[model samples]
Target chain A: MKSAVKIMFLSALFAMCCFSGNARAYEYQGVDIRGFISQGYLQSTDNNFFAETEDGTSQFNEAGINFSAEVSDRLRLGVQFLSRDLGTIGNNEVILDWAIADYHFRDWLGLTVGNMKFVHGLYNETRDLDMVRTFILMPQSVYIEAWREAISSIQGAGLYGDLGLSDMGSLSYDLQYGTVNLDSDKGAARLLGDQWPFEGMGLLVDVDQINVDYTYAGSIRWITNLEGLILGGSTWGYQFEADATTLLDTTNPMAAAMLQNNPGFVDLVGPLNAYGARFMLSPSEFGVETVSYTASMEFMWRNLVFAAEYMRTTYNIEFRNSPLFTTLEPVLSANGVAVQDGTIEVDQFSSVGYYASLAYRFAPWFELGTYYSVYYPNEDDKDGKERVAKGLDDQDHRGWLKDIALTTRFDVNENWIVKLEAHKMDGSAILLGADNPAPEDPAEDRYEEDWYLFAAKMTFHF
Target chain B: MKLRSIPLIARIVLAGIVLSAFGGFIVPAGHAASEVMVVAHGSVPVESLSRDAVQEIFLGRKTRWSDGQKITLATLKEGEEHEAFLRMYVGKTPHQFKNYWKSQVFTGRGKAPEAFTSPDELAEFVTNTPGAIGYLPQRAYQNQLKSFMIE
Candidate 1:
C-alpha cells in the first residue's frame, strides 16, 4: 500500500511537471494548489515512559507532508501524508491524515462535508498548518487514544457562520455532526493467496472506519463585539459528543469493550449529553507606538472535556443466561464466592471537567498562555483499577493535569513562516496511567509528570 | 592690545554687519504654515475639534458626526504624501488601519469605507454625496466643497 501511494504521488508529480512545461496551463481563477514538507528534531528530558508520549524523547523525527488545493472561492480540498520514528523503539508508520472539503458562503455561512479534522476551538482548524499555529503538539487533553480516530478527526459534515446582531455586536458559530469508522467487515475471501484481513491492517489503509459504532458531536459558538468607549470582545462556545458501538463481534475487542462498558449502548451511542461553554473578554485598545499589549481572561465550564465528564451516559446490555450457571450453580461454586444465575448489567458513567485560561499577546505573532483542566471518571466502576493501570482511566483522574505553554511565530517572508514553541506540563498522571501506576492513596501516589518538548518548523507556499 | 588699535566707527560697522547677517537667517522665507480643513458635500457644521477627535474621525474609530449623522470618509488610493498626512494627523499607518477594518469585517462588526484611486475621483464623489468627507493638498482646494475649520 505504501509503495502504491508513493508511486501514485511520483507519477502525478511527473505528469503535472510535463503538463506545465508543455501546454502552459492557465491558473484556475478561484483554485490554488499548495504543498509543504516539514521535518524536525526533538530532544526531551525523559524517555521510556508511556506517560503521555510513548513516542519517547528523540532527536530524530520525520514530519508529514501536506498537499492542499482550493476547489473554489468557497470550497477547499486537503491531503496529508505522515511518517515518524518513535525514538529507538523501532515503531514507525505512515498514514493518510485528512482528506476533506470545506465550503464558505458570503463569509457569514460556511459548511464542511467529508472526512475532516475536529474543530474544537481556534487551534483545531489551523493546527496542521504550521504557518498558522505556533505550537508543534496540540493540546493533549482533547487528543487521547481511548477513541483514537474520534479525537483528532471525524467523518461527517460541519457548518460554521457569522451573524451580526446590531450596531453594537455579532455572533460566530460552528456546528458539526459526524462518525468515526473504526473497522470494516469483509463477507468473503479473496481469489489471491493474500487474505482480506492482512490487506486491511496497518497505517497504510485510508480513514475507512469499519464498524458502524462511531462518535457523534456538535459545537456552537457566539462572539460579541462590545462597541463602546473601551472596546472589548467576548466569545462563548459549547460542544457535545457521544460514542456508540456493537460488541457482539468477538473479533473486535475495542468495540466489544465499549459496548460492555456502556450497557445502555443504544441511548448513549449518539450525541451524549455533554457541553462546554466559555466566556472571555479582551480590551481592544492597542497602546500607542509600535509595541502593544492585549490581555484576555476566560472561564470555561465543560460538562465533559475528558476524564470526569459531568454528563451521564446510560446503556442497556442484552444477555442470555448460561445454562451451566442457571441449572448447575453448585458445580460452579469455586473458591468461596457464590455464582449467580443470570445478571443484567446496567452501567451509568458520570464525568465532568472544566478549566480557566489567561492569555496575553505582546505582539502580532507572540503570545503566552496557560490553562487548568480538571476531570473525574466513574468512581464506582469496578474496572477502573485495571483501566487506570493501562492509562485508559483518563476519565477517572479528573484533576490530574495542568499545562502551560509559550508560543511565537516569525514570518520569514510573504509565503514562508517559522514557529517556535515550548510547553510546561504537570499533573494529569491518570491520563498517563500506562506510563505510571495508579496511586494507592490517590494523594500519596503524587507523581510529577513534567517534561519540556520543543519543535521548530519552516513552512512555504506556492 | 597696545600695538593694533582700530577706529571705533569701523568696529561699530563690523558689529552691525554681523548682527544683520544673523537676523537674515533668524527669520525664514516662503514659510507659510498651511491650515487644514474638514470638507463635506452638504451641511457639516464648523466645530472646534481636538486632535484626538480628528484622529478618531480619520481612523474610522468614529463613524458619526456630533449631530447624529453618518460621516462618509474618503481617501486616495496611492501617494507618498497621503501616508505622511495620515501619520502626521491621524497617527496611524494605512496598513494598520486596513488590518483594523479587516478584523471588523471578519467579525461582522463594521462596514469598510469606500476607496478611490485619485483625489479628483474622491472630490467628485464627495461633491455629489451628502455627508461625504475628504481632504487634499491646499493647492487642490475648490469651492464645490465646504471647508470645515478644525481649530
Candidate 2:
C-alpha cells in the first residue's frame, strides 16, 4: 500500500512538472497546480518540546502539492497530498490531506463531499500552508500539535454558504460531519499512553489503533462592516475508541520478582509466549468523547495584523477491563481503593486556552510578529496545587503553560519565505509523556518549569 | 548562557526595526490619482457597476454577471497600476490580495484569477474572453473592450 501511494505521488509530480513546462497549459486545460516545500530547524535550551528539540533536531519539515480544476460551470474537483515530519510526530508519511468535490448552486449555498478540511478557529484550514503565515509554528494553545491528525480533516460531507448583508457586511458558514483516521504511533496515542497509572512499575502501554467513530464540526464567521475585520465562532465534537496492549518489563528486578511470586499473575499475563515476553497483559479498551468550542477574531489594516482567540474543550475518558488492573486490584485494595469491575473512569474535565497575536509589516519584505499564549490542562486546577496534593501529578507547574513568542519573517520573493522565531515558556503542561519519560525517582520533577525554544525555517512554493 | 545572549538578541532586533522603518520610506508609493479604468469584454451587458459590486466580483464572492454569464477574471501580476487598482476598488493591498487568492485556491474555495505580465497581455485576454473583466491604466484602453463607469 505504501509503495502504491508513492507511485501515485511520483506520477502526479511528473504530470505537474510536464504541464508546468508549458506555462499556457494551465490556461488551456483549466487546471491549476501548486505546491510547497519547507525545511525547518528547532533547538531548545531544555525539555524535548515534542521531538528531541533539546538536541537541536532538524526533523521539522513539510512538503505538499495540490491540484484543482473546474469540471463544470458549477462543479469543482480538488485534492492535496502532504508529507510532514516534526521530530517523531509526522515521520514524513505521505497522506491525502484533502480531496473534495464542491458544487456551488447559488451565491448563498454550496455542498462539498469527500475528505474536507476541518474548519476551526481562524487559521485551521490554512495552518499547513507555511507561505501564508508569518510564524513557522502556530500558537499551540488553540492548535495543539498532538490533536492535529484528529482535527485536520474529515472524510464525509459538508454544507457551506455565504450570506451578504449589504452595509452590514457578510457572513459565511460551514457544517461538516465525518470520521478521522488516527495513527497509532502519533502524538494522540502517545498522550493516551501517558495516562496509564502503572507505568511507574515498569509497565508500558502501546496504543495499536484509534478509530474515531464520528466527528462533527461547524463554524461561522462575520465579515463586519469594519474593513479587514473578521469575527468567528467554531465548535467540534468527537467520539473515539482505542485498542492498547500493556507489557511488564522484566528488566526491572522488582517487577520480575513480584510477577514470579504471584501465581495469580499467570491469569493476568494471558498467552505471554505469543508476545515473546514473560508477561503480556490482556488487551485493554480505551474510549474518549470530546467537545470543543473556540471564539476567534482577526483584524488586518494596511501593514498590520492582529488576531486573538479563546478555546475550551471538555473530555470524558474511560479505560475498561484491563488485565493489569484486574491483577493489581487485590493488591491495591489492601492500601486503598481498587479498580471496580476492572474499569477506570477518568472524571470529566475541561481545558481552557487563549492567545493574542500581533504582526506588523514594517517593510514590504520584512514583518515582525509576537504573541502571548496561555493554556491550562484543567480549568478546575488553575495553579495545579490541588493536583499535586492529590498525587494526580508530580509538579504544580504541570497544570498550565504560558508562552511568549517573537518572530520575524522575510519574504525573499513571491515564491520564497524565511522565518525566525523565539519562544519563552513558563510551564511544561503540554509535553508528551513518551518524549519526557517518567523518572526513576518519584520525587524528582520530570520536566523543567521554564525553557526557551528557537526555530528557523525556509519555504519555497510554486 | 541563555540569559547572557538576551541583550545581544535584543540589540539585533532593535537594529532590524530601525532598518525596516528606513526601508519603508524608500518604497515607491504609486501615483495617487492615476486613472484606472475597469474594462470588460464587449459582450458584457452592464455599462456601469457599484464599487461594492466590483469588490465582490474581484474577491470571488460574485461568480456571475447580471445576464448569468460566467465571470472570467484577469489581473496583472504586479505593477504600480495593479497596486492602485486593488487598493482603490478591492480595498486590499497587493500582498493581502495575493494571500487571499492563495488561501482560496489552495483551500479549494475558489480559482485564482488569470494573471498577466503586462497591461497589453491583460487587455488582450479581456478582449478575447467573452465574459472577462479586468482593470487597466487609461493609456492601455482600447475599443475592443468596454469600460465600466464606476457609480
- By DockQ, who's the top model here? 2
lDDT of 1 at A7: 59
Instruction: Supply the DockQ value of model 2.
Output: 0.44
lDDT of 2 by residue, A1-462 (tens): 876876677576556545655222233366678877788988777788889887778899888778889999899999899888888888777899999999998777999999999999999998888888878889988998888877889999999987888888888899999998899988888877766655545566789999899999999999887878989999999999999877777666656766776668756765554445446777788899999999999998877899999999998988876566667776546435357788877778998999999998766698889999999988999898966764556789989999999888888877678887888999888889878876778686688899888888988776
Model 2 misplacement above 4 A: A1-28, A197-203, A249-266, A270-278, A322-340, A439-444, B1-33, B139-144
- Report RMSD (Å) for each prediction in the order shown: 20.6, 3.4
**Model 1 lDDT per residue over A1-462, tens place:** 866765565454345434444212213453222333344444333322222332334433333444455554345666555443333211234555566666655445677777666544333444444443334555444322232333345667777665544443445555556655432211100000011111111101111122334444444433223211222121212122212121122233433353454445323233322221111111011001111111122222111011111122222221222431233233224212243444212232333323444433233333333444433333344334533433333332233444564444444443455555544555443233223444556455334445444444455432
Native-to-model Cα distance after best TM-score fit, residue A396 in candidate 1, in Å: 9.7
lDDT, candidate 1, at B107: 22
Using TM-score as the measure, the top candidate is: 2
* lDDT of residue B63 for candidate 2: 83
Residue A287 of model 2 has an lDDT of 90
Question: What CAPRI class is candidate 2?
Answer: acceptable
Model 1, runs deviating above 4 Å = A7-30, A47-112, A143-148, A183-210, A227-346, A350-399, A408-410, A414-420, A428-462, B1-151
True contacts kept of 1: 0.00
